[model samples]
Target: MAMTHLQPDPSPYPADAFAAFELLSSAILVIDDDGLIRYANAPAEDLFEVSVRQLYAVQAGDLFRDGEQLRQSLEEARRHLFADKRQILEIDRLGREPTQVSVTVVALDGQPWPALIELREIEQQLKVDREERLLEQAQANRELLRNLAHEIKNPLGGLRGAAQLLEAELSDPALIEYTQVIIQEADRLQTLVDRLLVPHRAPRIVGDVNIHEVCERVRSLVLAEYPNGLRIVRDYDAAIPEFRGDKAQLIQAVLNVVRNAAEALSARIAAGDAEITLRTRVARQVTLAKQRFRLALELHVMDNGPGIPPELLDRIFHPLVSGREGGSGLGLTLTQTFVQQHEGVIECDSRPGLTDFRLLLPLP
Candidate 1:
């Protein structure tokens, strides 16, 4: 949606015509020479979430949430308008929900008969500005993830080979154990690097597959990991249609997210508080990867734990960023890449109390 704003045009009224123009402006309001509101502008309607016609039906004193303060400000504006020729005041309008507005009062050049009061809504402007910043940040992250993953692939192979050679040359059994550790660690790194390259690899197979089957497979694996302490809940919409995708890739993608959630909840599981819910539903008029589809699958992995740490929340999908200690962090990155390959998108929302990872995939 296009953002809305209240902008005032340059006043055509001369200093003497201040009150007259104030009455005509979409923002200006005129009061009795005593500064009681007698007229308001169209824009004031939005500031109060009321009709402009209803504005005058109510007294200015009755319109302010803080009526006494508003009355005081009006009195001050009245005192200053005639003396200084103009004054700026902040007034809070009265209602079940009150609105704060900035009002400017200007005295007419020739007569003190009328005063001008301008109304504006600053809150709406701030909301739009914040959304713009968030969108820009999300875009930058996507680009960074793509570039960083590509850059890390070359050195990873050499490290893996060097560890393997050192493992073969070690003579002492105990010393060889250290080399084996290096080899194991290098192999783990190799797996992560391979995951980073998954998106670039072509899908080996594609066919119609039921999403629920995929979910169930992942659920079984997760349940096996936390058989005693964790609970895996399924909320499936059976009405959802099958989609064309690589079955194995989809399983791996879903498994990665579920496993990560299970890992994150390990402490909670030990305390008997871990609960992971896998929900599937169909979303209409869905958009993924900037393309709109008439219908899409919505998969949610919701966990009840301490939730993701605040500092790492935004970068959760980026390569090598993880909230978990001793985590390689490629799980989510590969999950995202696999989903994206199928023309899907993944989003996450995490706070102290709740964390939800959502995937939207286009249906066949």
Candidate 2:
């Protein structure tokens, strides 16, 4: 909404003054000199989760969770302390996630309404920005690792060969054991290098993939591994149409995510209370890999377990960044790579009791 539009009660300012703001995407609120809400545009009503008439004569600041900060801004507007000020704050919503918004408060010039407040939802914008950064960083990581893998391949093979030859020459059992350790460690590193290079391999086997099929495969695999004490629940969206993607790669991506969730529930597994859910839904007008798509498939792996540590959440998708003690940490990296190959994106959100991993792939 245009904060610059003259605003106030209908009696003081004509109805036409608020006409243009009704079409605005941003939310606009006009407060009288006493800091009471005189008018709210259509967008504002949506933002506040209330009607424009319901907001009338209400204290504008009281609408926010942290109203004191907004109240101070409104007070400043009434006294003409500053022309305009902007701040980021959260808007409280009942039974829903709080909306983070960029609020701009402008002191109107010689108008009946002294304060013009603009609320722009930044959550979606933040998600887009974050997704873009993630894409860029993942690309850089892939390039760096691919180059490193190529450089290490020859030396890694040589190290294993030298250890094997040294072991043959040593008749002494003790010396042979040392060479064996060297060979095993070299092989381990080689395996890791191979995993790092897997994403660089092109020509994925693409086909019309049923998302539920992929989830079922992963679910059965995970349930087999944790069968005694864990439960894998299916919440499939049957209406989701088949999309073109690499079936095997999609299965691997989903497997990695679900397996990770299972691993995280290790503690709960022993107690027989661990649960993992495979939920699928159809999303419309969603953005993935910095590109907007009309339709997309959303697969969520939700778990009730001890969540990922806060320190490692941001880097979980990076190569060699695992939360588990013995984890090689390439699962999520490869998962993201596979999803990105299909013009999709993966996101994670975790807290104390719940951890959710969502994969978004464009639908044909």
Candidate 3:
């Protein structure tokens, strides 16, 4: 099914004919008649894990494991100038998991680069879908948790007050101890309910926020708690500009993520190898919560710790779901609420030794 190797033909257009697509979110590749890659845009290079100069050095067929199928698609594309030919390919590359890429080939007649191929990694689309679903779930949980917390909160106060009065009138020491236990447990549950209601009561405090400052503050707070063995690293992009957001809410949101990572590193911390990295970068042409933004701030909180349990990965942000013993599980829920208030998103990816919590917020 391979096409006959065509001789080199001089293209009439300038070398930058496909310049407009370089900034496109999808990967763009322009293949010459000989099947040599003449141009690989930024996203394409990123998708293939190859630089433009290096991408040119390899034959186009080398990028995919099923080269014959790709060649057959190309042959068909070459025969029909106006037809759209598509194939899903597993891009073969080193040090990266094989990616499922949807390859779309469109023929351009009377052009130097006779074929334009677009490569879109399906994983990114799946990631967006996952984020949207998480956002919706978080919203629903917030409403349900708020109402449930209130329902439990009212009777809790009466129970504690009754226990206190019963303890005051008791003369037997053994029975007094039982009343004391009841009061203590009631107080503990009340505190938990107060935490559940905190996010709803906090007002949005808007201002220009520098993400680095937020990271630094969270680092300081986390280090104060786990100072003996934990190390916080800052990997920041100095060029990222400030955007309008709730500084306090952003601080709390990032704090929850970092703190959760730190908590997960308990074994690592005890072993004297705990580490958390706060990374910041500028994301362009980004979409969050269904709205597109020309620029967005990308913040990642990464930890070298035992990763989140696989069973709880999808529901970690839901209220009262925690992977750790004695965890209240409200941290990530509040974090999600705060980020969504600013029209942003928070997502987590975890494996055995690595965990990444990414926050994507549109920049003004």
Candidate 4:
């Protein structure tokens, strides 16, 4: 989907317009002609790490650590309608980490609002660049996997055929057993190759997808497998609207991640402390890939297990990199592919006891 620049709507204020502000990727602040904050979007709330109600109660100047510099910037913005200046400012909020953000201030022309301010994290810009690199790497990996599969696929048939013919010619049962083993191994490899190519061959079926429903489906499947001790918890925000996506593909993507968590929790499950939480929340002004959405869904799959091994953590999403024995590492690679197909991104954070896999997808 192409992202268009946001222009001032010519129509009179509509009820939906208010809700739409919550979806912007940039944090917006509407300053009254009197230099007070008249309005703030959801991203602004997140950027300042304050609730809208609390944000409204404080003076706009109090938001920045360098109040003097911000005050001067606001003054220049009001005087020059086309003014656009970039600055580094520290956010001020108690109990929250004091983080520096890259801020851009722009003066609005011929409107009730005097000026508007846009705030974005410096780290977020770095992440956007990193995601672009990861995307390029993923494309290369897909091509490599496809070519390698095809190479193995052709010889696989001949190898199996030769094994069958050898088994037929063997007179002694003991000699024939070796040929049978070769045939069985050949069939196993063929199945593995077929699995590797499934996502590329299947057409992406897009439709409206309710995130909680996908979570429920995965929860059911996991519970069926570890019914004794594993616990699946749901923390869903029912207000989140549905978005266009491939339901089956999403289900598969989410299931692969959750199932991996369940497998990792084998020890915890045996001790009755295993837990996986599926949490959903609404994110405002989130940028996925390069496009910014006014609203997006933040889904977190958190597990309590011996977290991902540090040595294998960085390469977890790379094709065929698995920490577990006898495991196929295609799960996260496929999950990342499915999410990217919907213009989304997946991130992971782990320590000794907690691991979180976050999926951010745009809302319709």
Candidate 5:
């Protein structure tokens, strides 16, 4: 059925009567008691990915995969028409890869039975909810890994001690050598277990942290590694506000990104052309981890080096994935986890001669 359009009659109300509807974050539609769509806002066009004229050609139920459920919701809204409450409904879209949407219905005055429908894309909300759950799961896994590592360590120590005792008592040279091999292998296993437990240890979160302090700490540490070859530069915006967070964890997070950049710049450093810049600024009206905020802190680490390999770029944040040979590959993953704990996001861009890592953190 073709959608019926409702052009408002000129009245004494303000010229911007539709302003509230246009500014709403939800996709909105106006309908009469007959259930014909009278109007839709910009968010409505975005929700359906169609122009107003195109959207007006179809019935409200036609947009949903499960039309019956939408009809039921509409009926429910009519039953409680003017109760001063919002009626929410969830529906699936009618398409190959169906998307979910949540809608709210409210009655509007100045008509016999005019109703307004507000729609929200639930797919993005679902993705955010999934990631939050994954983060929680990752934390749980870290705790389990820590306990398992400690349990393994106790047995490893006993095995190493037993091997040492056996090597001392053995009279045959070959048997004594085998016992020494057992002790060495146990020591190697212990080291691996310690590495596994590192992320699980609780960080001490205290003090009002000036992000510049964290950047400087990372800068000093990186320069200490390549004192003469690498040059660390700062481009700080002193007006950035202080945010409450775990100082040590923030330092480690910055250290990992900066140190990785320093490592990538090793060859250029040797050639006396290496440069790493640490920049900080305040971003307004930022969104991270699906939540929108009025302001945020943006810290960027940029380097002049052979950029990350294209093939390894996507998986850089995955555990055990690295661009450098012999790299343990846990640094970026740990950095992501730490920044996420602080309700922030880390993104990277790389080319042949330049690579940049940007961290966006909300101001608390």
Candidate 6:
């Protein structure tokens, strides 16, 4: 159904009636007793992706994908139940993905409007909750990996020593070669175990860090490696100030991200159209690591790769969770650890032809 072209009559209330609603972060809707939306606030316009003109006179129930529950709640309100009630609802925007919103119905008593509706994006709240869970999970993973690595290290040393002694006792060259293989494989396992233990060791080294310089260093290193078919683009903001962090670790973190992107773009690289963009901007009044900062920096690493697989995207930061074959999968886990050490967060967004890894860090 199309929105009715009916206009609101303002004579029943003060001229500044909706002024307070525009200031609120919550999306608000003023509905008449007929259940038609009389007015929608700025936040409502944004949340619904519709203008006030379009929402005006539209039945409030029509906005939701399944709004029968909403209609009942409104009926309850019109019967003089002025108590506020809240429930979750899904809104299907035209040609856009459906959005989940927490809706609260507040019944108005003997006023210009019969009801007031409030909408809040539940996904945004879930993101904050998910970040907290991720931080806790990462810490526990570090402790577990550290203990496991240490336990394996001692036995691995003894096993390699026994293999060497066995080789010394063997006179036949063929038998000695078998012992050498055992020793070589043992050393390889030891190296992998040490890498697993590295995150638990080496405290974060902190100093004045220029983010742009870090990006430049990683850019040069990556370009040197993929000089033939890949390109690294820089779109940086000069306003980002220096922050106290481990410059080396930050470089490693960026390098890991860029290198991963390059690897994912191997197909595109062979096609001679591979590209990775390093874009930076200053983020103001942002939240990271459960703390709100007046200023933060956003570093976006974008690539024209095929993108991460759907199954591996969520677990990309987990140890040994690489998407590519023969991949150790520790790159992103260590990158996450390094970024978290500086009170930052890294998240990825991907589709078929594009992938973006965004890192946010607080600034001094």
C-alpha positional error of residue 110 in candidate 4 after TM-score superposition, expressed in Å: 15
For model 5, residues 307-328, the per-residue Cα lDDT tens digits are: 9999988678776678888888
- Report the lDDT tens digits of candidate 4 across residue range 94-199: 6767778888878878766667777888887788788888878877888888899999999999999999988888899998989988999999899889877877
> Tens digits of per-residue lDDT for model 1 on 1-364?
0112324333333445444532332366566644444455554554555554565534465554455554555566566534323223344444433444554445444544444555544453354354345445545655675576567656766776787787788788998888777778777766765665566665658899899999999998888877888988889999999989888989999999888888888789899978989999887544354444667899999998778887888778777788788887778877876777687777788876578998889986
In order, what lDDT does every prediction score?
Answer: 0.68, 0.84, 0.82, 0.83, 0.76, 0.87
lDDT tens readout by residue for model 6, 151-185: 99999999999999999899999999999999999
Most accurate candidate by lDDT = 6
Ranking by lDDT: 6, 2, 4, 3, 5, 1
Off by over 4 Å in 2: 1-120
Maximum-TM-score candidate: 4
Per-model root-mean-square deviation over C-alphas = 11.3, 7.2, 6.1, 6.5, 9.3, 6.6
lDDT of 1 at 10: 38
Higher-ranked by TM-score: 1 or 5: 5
Q: Model 3's lDDT to the true fold?
A: 0.82
lDDT of 3 by residue, 1-364 (tens): 1222344345445867877886577788777666667777787766776567676534566678787776666666667645668888887667767778888888877776668788878878787787788877888898898999999999999999999999899999999999999999998998988888888987777888998888888889989999888999999999999999888888889988988888889889999999999999998667688776778999999999989888999889888888888888899998988889888998889998999999989987
Model 2: per-residue Cα lDDT over 1-364, one tens digit each = 1022233344577768778776655678888877777778776776767666677777777777777899899998888899999988887776888778899999988676788898878977778789999999999988988998899998989989998988888899999989989998998899889888887775688788998888888888887887788999999889999989899999899999888888888889999999998999987657676665767888889999989999999999998888898999899999999988899999999998999999999888
Per-model TM-score versus the true fold = 0.56, 0.70, 0.71, 0.79, 0.63, 0.71
Better of 2 and 3 by lDDT: 2
Backbone clashes, candidate 3 = 1
Q: List clashing residue pairs in candidate 5.
A: none
Instruction: Evaluate model 3: give its TM-score.
Output: 0.71
Better of 2 and 6 by TM-score: 6
